[model samples]
Target: MTEMENKAVGYTVQQGVATITMQSAPVNALSRAVRVGLIDGIESALSDDSVSAIVITSSLALFSGGADISEFSGGDLSPNLPEVLDKIENATKPVVAVLPGPAFGGGLEVALACHHRITFAGNQVGLPEVNLGILPGAGGTQRLPRLADPATALTMIVTGKPTSVVKLPGVFDKISDKPEHLLEDTKQYLASLNAENCIKRTSDITLTMSEEVQGVFDAVTAQTKKAARGFFAPLKCIEAVKGAYTLAFEDGLKHEGKLFMECMNTPQARAQQHFFFAERAAGHVSDFDKSTPERSIEKVAVIGAGTMGGGIAMNFANAGIPVTMLELKQEALDKGLALIRKNYENSAKKGKLTQEQVETRMALLSGTTTYDDLADVDLVIEAVFEKMEVKKTVFTTLDKVCKPGAILASNTSTLDVNEIAACTSRPQDVIGLHFFSPANVMKLLEVVKAEDTSADVIKTCMKLAKRIKKVAVLVGVCFGFVGNRMIEPYGREANRLLLEGASPEQVDRVLTQFGMPMGPFTMGDMAGLDIGYYVRQSRQAFISHDPTYGAVADRLVEKDRNGLKTGRGAYLYEAGSRVPIPDPEVLEIAKQEAARLGVTQRDDISDEEILVRCLYTLINEGACILEEGIAAKSSDIDVIYVYGYGFPVYRGGPMQYADEVGLGEIVDKLSTYAERLGDYGKMWLQPSDLLIKLAQERSSFAKFKN
Candidate 1:
């Protein structure tokens, strides 16, 4: 046997077979080194007299996750992915690809380029380039449709989601009978192939547009438009796929490359890609790493049995871990359990879960009515009321009942985590796992680090976040942590805009056009107007200084208009519908609130002014957050806002959007607003010092070394 080694991949000949193994550990990112090695390895195998067949597989690593995204930040390198893939597809000898795990995006493109592809039952493959706001540049959109059903291929490309090897029939030449025997299956598959049959290329396959396929294209295009709405990449992906059917293979490849470049240069692409890295970066803690040991949280307990608590308990059950739901009474416990069952059954009805799978997950959850039931739990998170005293009582009980080293978490969105930690004897074990409402679904989890929280606790919770499929953004303890704190100024401005001049519909229209899922007024109405009224009462200073704050919302609730529940709030809802219709009555109420609060109502508020005030105030608060070190890095704040607050994903959260809008522009706009509003603007809307510095220097939060 002869061996040839490179930095990222190796070439070796054993018997009549040449094996090219990728050496990048973990997810073998298709970096420049790997591309060079792949081209070199294939050429070496072709030249060697002893080598009759070739197999490309990773060396003790999961299959490639696609392009090395970090490399994207730099200039072009030699032998790009397309060049490497073309070398593989055009190889002389029979080439086989053995996928060990997921082959996503460009990685799947590489496998598609091989003459014969083989994988295990559980292995997945996809061209998910649409996620990064780009279509597949290296022939993925072109070649995938050549082998698979065009609609299926188009669906996979448009959605940017991985599919099981078995689910995609024509794509893989051979599949392992057992999930663990992919290598054996590939060897047998290679043994069956000779040069006469093994040298087939995806480019030679012809694709034709049929009536059904055209229908699929139309349906998917419409669906993508509706679902992704303002997104730029998904529609581009469909266009690239359509090229595969209309144009020749080489032409399709060229078109795909053009589309890829077009999407890559888009601001939406930059924003989505920034969020991709930001979400991953949020998991890393600067002070502690692998050396900081994490405690096990196998068994969990969630106190309270309401919507938040029940949803919190479901996350553990879904992960196949035992969870105890402890309410003060049996009735509450049973009601919570029923809601959890209903949620799972609904998923089962939707085919998202099998009946057996639903039962299996439900079996992992149990309900109890005593604090003593939580003693044996590894972690206990209180999902009770948001008041400080109520959280203290829960922590005090948890401290007395929970085992030593057990984590005590509070699901308090606006209260101090440190004060709750102070009520416990084990302050080091206390942290905040603040799951957003409908906890089983929302991705953002603010891991609030209290004053006395230990590194181990942080590490454990961070690790646990991965298990539960949540993006854990570590934040210092403060009022409302990151998401709520930032939203305060944003919501404040939107509401104040209502009283000053802008109608509810006008403010909402401006924000939605700026790419928020919904404006603050719509969100407040859906969340219930009374909720804001009570929150305003709690923060007397938060509202007292600014008389216009919460005035419309307070008056709406006083009229028994509590939003969707009451059929009226900021906007009136027709019976049995959630579509908020702009009511003249609501505008009249706003005018009255403005008069009562002694705020001057002006008709000159432009849509641009509304957009700037709402988003810029949010950005200003984000800057203050960065300056205070409450958020570890600026990107973390971006991730929290995008995932937690429905701040536009394509705009890359508040800070990234600000950087794109020009920091200097923001400083000028904010300064102008402060001067225009006098004392109120100076007190509330002044640009943070960090924003002034970054803007003057023409720097971006995305360019930060952290």
Candidate 2:
């Protein structure tokens, strides 16, 4: 005698089907009440003779965001999500899960319990529990391999990366184009899958390996070693997948569950999860009223047609917005426009975009050498050279030509947004929209708020960044704002370290080992050392007194070895490719520079020292940035690094990495480094007092909210 009771879960039995919906708002996070309701819902559906089949879905934008993250941090797991999902898997009635948005974490586990999964187009699904100091305890590790190949399951679970619905491969039974008609569509598909059999458990299925499975595993391992590096979850994910091949059904489930629990207690998982929420938290700012009106940004204009402007224009154009790109000369405009077409063409070649879609988007872009085209734009982003006078001139011209109520923005990486705003008649409308290099691809957008900038203007800029598929971090105005401000010292330390003992290759290798995509020398080579040389020249007076600050970078620029563009820099490149070779000349130069700087050249620089010098310095500066209010929160700084600077996702970001290293230990190391090296060396080495204070109280950056 199964009974139906309405609670956190909503259930309806109609026309031989029972639709069980997780009725939690925001993100249907699997809570205790929801788990209990789900278990009861499955039982009721299974006992009802009228309900021949059952369908499960979420009543939110997301199917399920996994388990409530807060539950694992000392909060009870509530009858436990795994226990509830087990009941669903054992249900006699055939169960189907229809996913509209993302089925993440336990959400994916719930779907895995059902015999079949039907997802809508654009849906994202993954077992991302590895990020939260836990693995998918709800049978995800055991069931994923039964549904997909071991290698595919390994990649999805271990990496904790999302799989797009368009490229889901073997994860789901079917993916429909129209999600609004998902139930009907799924029912029609289910009619085809109908048999005498009832719901079957994924654990009972035997996974067959392909002939190239070993080769596949080998390739995946090699890439994971390079990409994940110090991260443990990815390797553990591989182990879980291998379990499917070596162990029996029950044994595999036990092995998977054990590994999943081991991942839950790892420091890496905690850090990654902290970063996950930090990224979402980056959007919130104090005094930024929710009621602030967002300007309608449809037709947009970019003042410069160079690389930055071209990329910025592409972001707007890619979002289906009509963008007018302006350049001073026809030749410059043509060159920029050609690059835009080439970018689209490259994307089409990579199958990232369809040819017709590329052409359609490219057709939406227009170019001009005059300000008349700017009149119709709701927003204008000035990407001219980062000079105050040039920016002021552009703003002055824009003020006269742009229509009223239009938002004016500067894509300045470090320059003062307030100074740029000062040139305009409507200073309140001026805001900073700092996009990382390769704007169309990079996710970070530092939304700098000037003292006089209107709330609506800032809100509109943040909203616009999202519309263009960029992660916008609301920041207070500063010289370099959040990302680049902290980056200055971090980059400075890398250069200083080279002059002290480390070579270009050694420095980059050390930082790369610490999980940075590239070291300072490699980055310098990529960005062209001349830019840093020029920036140093701009700040010569401030840095000149300290020979350790700009000397090595100045020497690199003086050698006329700019970067990859010149086939030489800190490291030499083998023509046409970006791969760096350890140049003997650069090593000799580093030795000479160390001698010249009166710094000890030691061959015994431990990997630990190298990691601490590079990462801790970056984290210390992040703390300073937080204190100065340049960044709204520690999470904002984390987002700046994770997205903008290629900080490793699994280690979270610099701030989360600091928490993992134990902030007290970081303070001790910084104090030791400061004592050995002078203040110049200690500039970045000094521990953030905020970090020290937090450490003393046994707190974490994750605990500190804005």
Candidate 3:
């Protein structure tokens, strides 16, 4: 027996079989070193007469995360993934790939290249390159369809979601029932394969072209166009798969490579990849050390049993943490509990949760009308109204009732966490867990770090957010923290655009076309215009200087047009329908409001101007947030917008979008808009000094420090 080793890979030969082990810890990324080692190990196995069969497996927990995305941004390295995989496929002896766990992206591509594949039944595999704005570049698109039916192959590649290897027919030659016996299973399967049972290369499998197959391609093309709007990779993924039916094996591989590069070269891909790293980066606390401790949260309590409070409690319940939902009255408690049950029941209906699972989560949630019931709770989150005084009152009571060392959290979106912490005796234990609307559904949780909040509490909440499955972003205490602070200017500009002559639909169309899930006005109407109307009222001192800041919205709310609740808002909703229909009365209201404010309502507004005015201002405010240290990094802001607000994922977050549009270009546009609108634009859309400095230095937000 002989053994060989490399930095990220290992090779050993025994019993006439050679094994290649990927040992890169924390998801074996197919990096340059790994690639080099694979080529070396395979070449040695092929030349050695002692070895008849080669097996590729990982020494790590999983097969691999994917291709090293960090490598994608840099220059090409020797022995790229395609060349390595090709070497494995062209080997004279049978090469078997074993997966103990999941294989995604290039990892699955590597396995597909092997002559035979074996995995545990529980293991999953996918070609999720489309998620990073690229199709499978390493012969995946061509090979997957050759092995699996084209429809199954198309769905897996296009959606970029993992599937069980057993579900993908012909992809895995053997599926082991139990994971503990993976080694034994692999050995048995290898022994069973005779010369007659030797499998052909995946690329050698022919896919017959037919009208029905073409229909599957056409239907997926239409579906991908609708589902993956403004995205470059999904459609390219479909095109690459289509080549499998039209082109031969070698030609299809070349076609796949062409489409992969085309998608990789797009700004959309750059943005998606940036977000992929940014979301992971959002969890790290820059100043925290390895020694930083995190507290355990066992029992939980939530104040207020309304929609927000109920949703907040559901998160803990879903995480298997017992929660006591406290309300001022029993009736409110019963109502909140019922609503929570209804939510669980609805999810059970969708098969997202089983009937037993729904009951289990519901049983974890208990309701009470007394603060005394929260005395033993490990953490208490105040999910009451947005008003500061209301939050203060809740915290003051929590400071008295909760056990010492218990973490107290506020579910406030925009109010100051610092001031809320001041209400409690143990300010260090008080942090803001600002969950978005429909808290159970929304992925973003702004972990607001107050000035007096201790590091342990911050770390503790961040870890807890992960337990509940959230994209937690640590942000400093401020008026609106990270997400909402930047959105103020966004909503302000969108409103001001109405006065300057852009209709509701026109502004919405421009923004939605630019990749936002919805424009500000439509979002405002859906969230209830009265909510913003009240938020404005509470912050009147902040916006008192500008009379026309939200005059149109204020007037609408004053006219009893709260939103869909009243079947009227910026646009009147037809009875029982949430669709926004243009109302002449709303336009008349805009005209009157504009005239009253002494502002001109000109129709010269173009879609480009509207896009710049709304997005660029939002970007400028993000720069301000970065400078203030409200957000530790630009990526944190992007994480908030992408997850909390429906800022388009393809566009990345606002900061990533700005970098793609060019920071210098953004600065220039802000200046131009300031000159065009004079005082109004200068007041609202002024670029921050940090933004100016980065632009002048020809730098991007991604590269900017401080």
TM per prediction: 0.96, 0.91, 0.98
- Tens-digit lDDT track for model 1 on 1-706? 8887796898889989999998787678888889999998999999999899889988654678899999888966778999998999888888888887788888899999998888778777888788888988899998899899877898899999889889887998888877578766766777787656878888998878889889999999889989998789999999999999999988898998899999999999999998998898898778578889989888999999899999999999999989999988898889899999999999999999999999999999998988998888999889998788788888888899889999999899989988889888889999999999889999989999998999999999999999998899999988888999988988888888888878999999888888888988899989998887888899997668777777887888989989999998888899999999998887788898888878899999988788778889888888888878899888999999888988888888888888778889999998999889888788887988888888878897666442
lDDT of 3 by residue, 90-130 (tens): 98889999998899999999999999988888888998888
Candidate 2 per-residue lDDT over residues 227-330, each given as its tens digit: 76777777777777777776886787788789977887777887777887887777776646877777888799999989999999999888999999999899
Q: Positional deviation of 565 in candidate 3, in angstroms?
A: 1.1
Give the C-alpha miss distance for residue 704 in model 3, angstroms: 2.0
TM-score of decoy 3: 0.98
Which has the better lDDT: candidate 2, or candidate 3?
A: 3
Worst 10 residues of 1 by lDDT: 697-706
Off by over 4 Å in 2: 1-7, 47-52, 58-63, 98-102, 116-125, 130-134, 149-152, 158-195, 207-219, 587-608, 679-684, 688-692, 695-706
Better of 1 and 2 by lDDT: 1
The TM-score measured for candidate 1 stands at: 0.96
Instruction: Give the Cα error of residue 230 in candidate 2, in Å.
Output: 2.3
Candidate 1 yields a Cα-based lDDT of: 0.87
- Candidate 2, residue 306: Cα displacement in angstroms equals 0.5
